[model samples]
Target: MAQAKTTLRTTAAAKAASKAPTNATADKLVGTLRDTMVSLVRRDGPDLSARQLAVFLTCYLQEEGHTVRGLAAELNVSKPAITRALDRLGELDLARRKVDPLDRRSVLVQRTLKGAAYLREIRSIMGETSTVAKKETETRVVRATRRAA
Candidate 1:
């Protein structure tokens, strides 16, 4: 009975130890996203709305073949909403709409150089923010361990 209890405790400890890194990673990701957004607003000043940001990210992060209809379906928004977002993106020159050669009715979303540059900047900001967050977390852990000891 004692052996069984020890084994169960060990298993629980292992699971908890495994989950600690995953939780830390998720926290860092959230922090990085927040920091990147603040940096983008402060530096670029496009002041993108939530829907606009969502649309922009979907276009840049996902594979090609993005169309108005496809984006609407993917985002669970109306076609007009997608169109409006596209219009805003167009105004910023971040994205352009091109009529599909195969289907004239379908409008394809294309990335621009400006948009690519913006994405690259965001990636850099995210990486830097994540690294900072990780260091802070490690420092906090070290402090806590010292306190415990």
Candidate 2:
């Protein structure tokens, strides 16, 4: 007696593979996101580079009483990375480091008056830009969607 032919097919497997993101596409997306964040920060304050602004924001947040460890975790960066950023801000005289009086082992970062002024200016610019961007995006999305007759 002859046995029926056995066959294996992978059409679904091929389609699934096709749907996956390519490394190049992922890299391009990362680059675009970096550029956009930089643009937004620049729109907020043309004076600070993206890196500088990132450091400044971290210091400002800490000055508002956030801990360095907390900021590092929230930012998804290592403690050293956060510390380096803070160092840059300190070097610029925008932030200062102080030893926690309650815990001698802990060092706290605080924003200086200059830092506060810079942050205020950035907030004003960012607020205006954010308003415009929100309106523009809303209009575009509405225009793109179909409306009932």
Candidate 3:
């Protein structure tokens, strides 16, 4: 009976210790993603705030045929926020506005060549960062599993 109790305690303690690293890994993942995103944005030749990047990316997605409502849902932002972003994008000439034929009251954002080129550049930069991050994450998981074992 004493042995069984010790075994249970040991298992529970191990589980608790293991959870710490898992949480750390989750935090690291978010940080890595943010860093990589920031780097990619810098490659656009101008430093952009995190909010700006999010707004620009949302607009870019919209230019690719996503509806404003869909973008708002995906970004978890309001329609007005999306509209403001779209206006900024237009001011920069990174996107174009087109009247939605089916909905005369609505406009569809379209990506201009500049926007397309910037996206392509960002993708090229992300390729390396993504590969490195994936490998590092995999390595951390393996190490955690070893400790758990």
Candidate order (TM-score): 1, 3, 2
TM-score of each: 0.82, 0.51, 0.62
TM-score of 2: 0.51
Better of 2 and 3 by lDDT: 3
lDDT of 3 by residue, 35-120 (tens): 67778656546444555567667766543676567667888889888777777677767667788899887777677888777767
lDDT of 2: 0.66
Considering lDDT, where higher is better, how would the candidates rank from best to worst?
A: 1, 3, 2
- Model 2: per-residue Cα lDDT over 36-147, one tens digit each: 5655555643345555677678767553665567667777778887777777777767777788899887777777888888778656655655565656657866877846
> TM-score of predicted model 1?
0.82
**Worst lDDT 10-window in candidate 1:** 40-49
Cα misplacement distance, residue 79 of candidate 3 (Å): 2.1
Candidate 3's TM-score reads 0.62
Off by over 4 Å in 1: 1-22
Q: Clashes in model 1: which pairs? A: none
Residue 68 error, candidate 3, Å: 2.8
Candidate 3: worst-modelled 10 consecutive residues by lDDT: 43-52
- Backbone clashes for every candidate come to 0, 0, 0
